[model samples]
Target: MTSYLIKSILCSGILIVVYHLFLEREKMLWFNRFYLLSALVFSLVVPLISFEIKPENVLKPVITAVPQIMEEMQKTGVINSMIATAESNSPPDTMQLLLFVFDGICLLLLIRFLVNVSSVLRLKSRCRNVKIASAKLILVPENIVTYTFLNNIFIPEKTFENAQVRDEILAHELAHARQMHSLDVIFIELIHVFLWVNPFLFWYKKAIRLNHEFLADEAVLKEYTNVKSYQLLLLDTVLQGRQMALTSSFNYSITKKRLAMMTKIKNLNRQYIKQGAIAVLAFVLTLTFSEKIYAQIEFKSKEVAATFPEISIVRFEAVADKPAKKPDQKGKSGPGISKAEIDEFYKTIERNTTYVKNKKGRTDPMVRMEPKMEDRMYELFSQMDTDQLQMAADSGIMVFQMPIPVKKAPTPEMFENWKKPEIFGIWINEKHVPNSELNKYKYSDIAEYSLSKLYGGALKGRIYKYQLDILTNEEFDRTYDRRANDRVIITRVGWVGENRPKSFAGRRI
Candidate 1:
């Protein structure tokens, strides 16, 4: 983007100087004082309409800036709703979206080959060549060197025959090229083309032009043995200056002040660094006013946490139901949970219900820092699977540790209890499967292997087994463990149900 700014500024000077050289002065009597206006119009109307603009190319930071704006918007409204804004194009409205599109299109036009080619065509004819000049080429006009990019050189029939005059002329153009007045002219033209809206840009162009002439004049005096010789040559060129359609000349009559600057003896380096610094500073300041885009997303996840720099919770929603109840119809032996057991469940629930509700109604403290991220986390958890919600809700989490099934002569009671549905999912970790030869234990092993690792308890032999003696249906008094007098506290609950393990005659570890 900075590069484009520099490039455009450079081209502006070239175009302006070229136009002044080629076009004749306007004769509109009423607009006599509007010579500057005419020049301005030429700079504005000519290239702008002469070329074309399209969104397909050109430098567009505005498009890039959109995403950044969106990100900022989201951050600002974390706990609330998105704040919407808009823009339009009519009447030169700047914030309008369409105008932004126009801005982007304009910025992008610099890249087109057609525009550069057009610029080249406008200044088609080369200025006179110089054998004595040390530069690639020179365009010293017969009039005061106009610094304007156009035809400053007034070519007449007998111009080159005067040896002393020609040498002085060579001295002057060499001054222009050495000091790079031509390049400076191009730079000003570019600034005018793109930044024509800026009034200060016009002043800057003039200042830079004046400086160029100053530098060139100094060079001419250094090259000539006597300052008088150069001054006489400049005078001769200025008097007989015949205008050309498209060249910068030695003595452009309009820029007489610039020639006078060249004639003066001056110290160049005393302020060179200071002036260069000012130009650089101005160039840098322009960057603060730029256009580019970026976006933001709030994501919350324990799994996703490892990958991201900031783990923002986007949405969280909790499912409102419990896991499907112990499947019915299967011949299952459920522990006859008594009134004592139900009371214990309520006690567990009461222990952890201390929740803080914020203005946005988030239930977790981790979410409050970034409202949007928290809201997202809340939404996700609120809508989670029933099994997860039930697990979160349940205080008495059961941890099952399945034991290896050692094959022994199968007892009638063991076989009978193993075939029940109440004990479906239960297992130890994968490593407990034992040798492959124990494959027979894979079938019907749930009750035999599963035991409460949290509280020494087990379910086997068609009954809910614990350390307490198993009683018949009549003897079972209702309680959490079916022991009316004693209650066991349940902590973490998990069922590592491995269907792959052999179920035949299994036992708890």
Candidate 2:
């Protein structure tokens, strides 16, 4: 999920960079319009496409080695995976809380979108409709600028009184209605509702809005030959209007680009050159963001088999690989684990502790297994010959881990000590701050924390013995600010093999 978001953002960024560098300056308004919409839609789509390459094409040097010792450990029963332990209570999952926050914000934006649409609908139903020359104008009571929504051109009662400006404004808005620019606004707004955090969407919106103004200006100039008068009128117009996300406003502060594009001469050669460059960029981005899969290949060498038989077995097994599921936390009952038996085993070890001299030259308790445990251990190894036993001893003692019930994830309540006044210095997300900084956050916002004793450190001329560090859930942090990080990170990580889920967003996009 993280990878998909990153790839989509990166692809959008690359396309945006090319547009700004090569296409924006050229006199190719039509091509620019097509490219802007196509690039945005392509950015959203290219990350979901992938190409598979057969393993025969992949280099063998870097991919041949496989870890086979893990398989041996599994066969020897040394990797006990079924050990069960008692379950304990835990804090609220931060990820779930972040998800809830995201959905809540999306709902609010959706409602706001609907409200804007309804307000337009209400105006369409109640306002006086006056048809002038080929345009439908909705005369509203408010002192706002002329704007277009769907098929209706909304005109302010104050702005409509002027005879000369009215014709020009209506002509501009008619172009918008004819070109269906409102649909573009609606589509981008819907995207903004969900992916508002994506900075590229904001850029895309600006580009889309600016392009609409250019198109409208081109249409108005075709009818009215006075480009200077139109530019002056645009400059003279005030930017006081009710900003609607779904409507294209006539008084947008994009007069400079609109005026420049009106006088600029169209060069066919330059347009073709820019289009070819954009095509190359699109192709490069497709390959860069795409997921590449390779077919399974088994390399067998007689020399490698004579040197390491285990690695050869692993290579063969790699030809038919499947996804490995993570071990379940709430394990079922299995061998070598029972509450009563574990308690008895610990009691035996405690009884057999003996005093011995340590490296510090002080006598400390050394724990040893009781004779009964020693007899059981010997019985397990009785079948091995002397050579096998010597080899085992040379490999050193192996400790088999048993699952113990404990709190693994940090809880918000655990930071209560640091929250107390003047008790410990607080640091949230690696920034030093006062203890009061924690007041705004809840348990579900924190991902993890650490406490450490400060030996001889003073902060703000006050001596502190301990300090607390906190790392909040990133999803929670991102909700507060959408433009926090401007840098885009592109990664080539993806899932492979037949076990990959069939109903994933990346696969469907």
Candidate 3:
């Protein structure tokens, strides 16, 4: 995941950098603009459409079978697998992660909005300190509204008094303001934020900014009378520092480019139709392959997803909550777990703390077991409905949701020494864990392991540490803000494959 994240960032960064280079050149050559815009649109649309094609409900059917299948396998000590999907993350979890990514995006957007608003407020404050020259500046009512959030233009009152050059400057900057190029610039900045890792994205920002200046220059030049004077005025103008997010200004950094753009010789004989066609083609070409970085990245992650990233043996522990449902609502346990499926979930707490009876000659009995409160709850959790899971979650009974770290994935070569082994006979020394020393077969000790094997996954060699606490509504709500780290340890981590013989028949069965 970390590698993929870094790669995605680098991909976006490259795009931004390339864009910056294009902007520095100060001319799009018609076709360039076509490609950039088209590519941006395509990149945005593909992921959304891909989601619908993949569908959100992809995991529902498999999850529906987990409990019953686990039960049967646990009961009969048989391996039950019809269609085993290799481990990636689940679709719901993936969707949640994507939402989390978007949440981060929204937070960034909000930060920008606040920063802009704060800057505007500061600007408003500066209005009182603003110095006005009564003698040197005379325009339409002393304030000509010369610039906006984008062009970042300002006249030193000395230059504004020149009536001849004034309107041209006003018109040029106005062109930028009318187009809301400042907002465009802000949007570009945000693109850089998301795609900053992509160097081309950095370039894209510069290119787009320059394009705005060019577009604005074209607008004013078409209407101004003395083109040479206007060009001279632009060339003499000092470009100011970039302003806050929402300011339009004149004298933006790309002034020389803007001046050069004005020098382009336009002739009546020049074929507009031919230029238009070439521009269109150029745009189409660019659009088809504009997003070299991000698109390439998206392709890589997809290809990698197909292979075994990790062997995720997912298991869910049932946490208790909710009142009893009608008997009809609880489906008959499919094979192995149906008998233990009776709803003594809470009362079984006493039975849970009791130790397992591994008497002489019992068939694969989990002799030593001390169940934690949470693990016991998880035993019951596998039996609950999705609605019940939600209720439990809402009612302070958290289902300790866990997925193994993606970092743990090992290569096929690494597994060369590993053997192909089927997990069987999950035993817990309930006498050793969180509860207390135990005597006879307390149902919870053996029953919980049975439940885990039946529903979650076969846990023969592994041990987890689980502990649960009964929290009030207030406690739950108070800590709800940060639940990511919270978990009830199941079985304490333990070694596996130490005692069991080559086969159950050879051991003691």
lDDT of 1 by residue, 416-469 (tens): 333322322122221221123233443333222211111111111212211111
TM-score of each: 0.32, 0.54, 0.37
Candidate 3's TM-score: 0.37
Ten contiguous residues with the weakest lDDT in model 1: 57-66
Q: lDDT of candidate 1?
A: 0.33
Q: Candidate 1 or 3, higher lDDT?
A: 3
Off by over 4 Å in 1: 1-155, 162-166, 177-180, 183-201, 228-246, 250-287, 292-509
TM-score ranking, high to low: 2, 3, 1
Q: What TM-score should be assigned to candidate 1?
A: 0.32
* Candidate models: Cα lDDT each: 0.33, 0.57, 0.39
Put down candidate 3 lDDT per residue, 199-221, tens digits, no spaces.
Answer: 45555556666676677777787
Candidate 2 per-residue C-alpha lDDT over 319-433 given as tens digits, one digit per residue, 9 for 90 to 100: 1122122212122122333445434433443354444433334333333453346344333333344443332233221111111211123443344434653445666765666
Q: What is the lDDT of residue 420 in candidate 3?
A: 18
Q: Give the residue spans of candidate 2 off by over 4 A.
A: 55-92, 132-135, 158-165, 298-509
